[model samples]
Target: MTDQPQGAPVRLTAFVHGQVQGVGFRWWTRARALELGLRGSATNLPGGRVQVVAEGPRAACEALLALLRGPGTPGSVTLVVEQFGAARGEAGFVER
Candidate 1:
């Protein structure tokens, strides 16, 4: 079987870098996450990094990571993706 986490929802955080800030990454993530039925938020950090927190099914959360690392808006390119450990039971995704 696949090594997916079971029982309860999975909380995930990803640090998206390179051409993320000011390129609609936050808005993209918020919309996508909501569409995928996940809860989290995306925001621009101080150092031109976009951070996203997503909590949902294992497959859905993993898919979000892929989207974050892939091509973003009109002028966005993902340089790297750094994923963190699991966190659970988030209220919802918000822009902060």
Candidate 2:
């Protein structure tokens, strides 16, 4: 096995679409990430997409991603995740 830590946190970019902006998406993610003891930020992109970067244990990160892609109202949300290497050193979670 490798010598690296097993539970080291990660950095991921999640693109949430469909009624994401102005729909409390950032708030929801911030709340959830905090509850999960994760750190990162969520923001609205130019083209109707909400982007989030969460850094924490793998399990919690996965849960956050699942919620981002869950079913919704008439205009349901779709989450596209792009896993990055890891969190360099983000301070905390916030809206940007």
The total number of steric clashes, by the backbone 3 Å criterion, in model 2 comes to 0
lDDT of 2 by residue, 5-93 (tens): 67887777787777777777788889888998889899889999878898877778888777677663224586565565566677789
How well does each candidate superpose onto the true structure, as a TM-score?
0.81, 0.83
Best candidate according to lDDT: 2
Q: For candidate 2, list the clashing residue pairs, or say none.
A: none
Off by over 4 Å in 1: 1-7, 72-74
Tens digit per residue, CA lDDT, model 1, 8-70? 567787777677777667888898899899997887789888778998887788888777766
Question: Candidate 2: what lDDT?
Answer: 0.76
**Where is the poorest 10-residue window by lDDT in model 2?**
72-81
lDDT of every model, 2 decimals:
0.75, 0.76
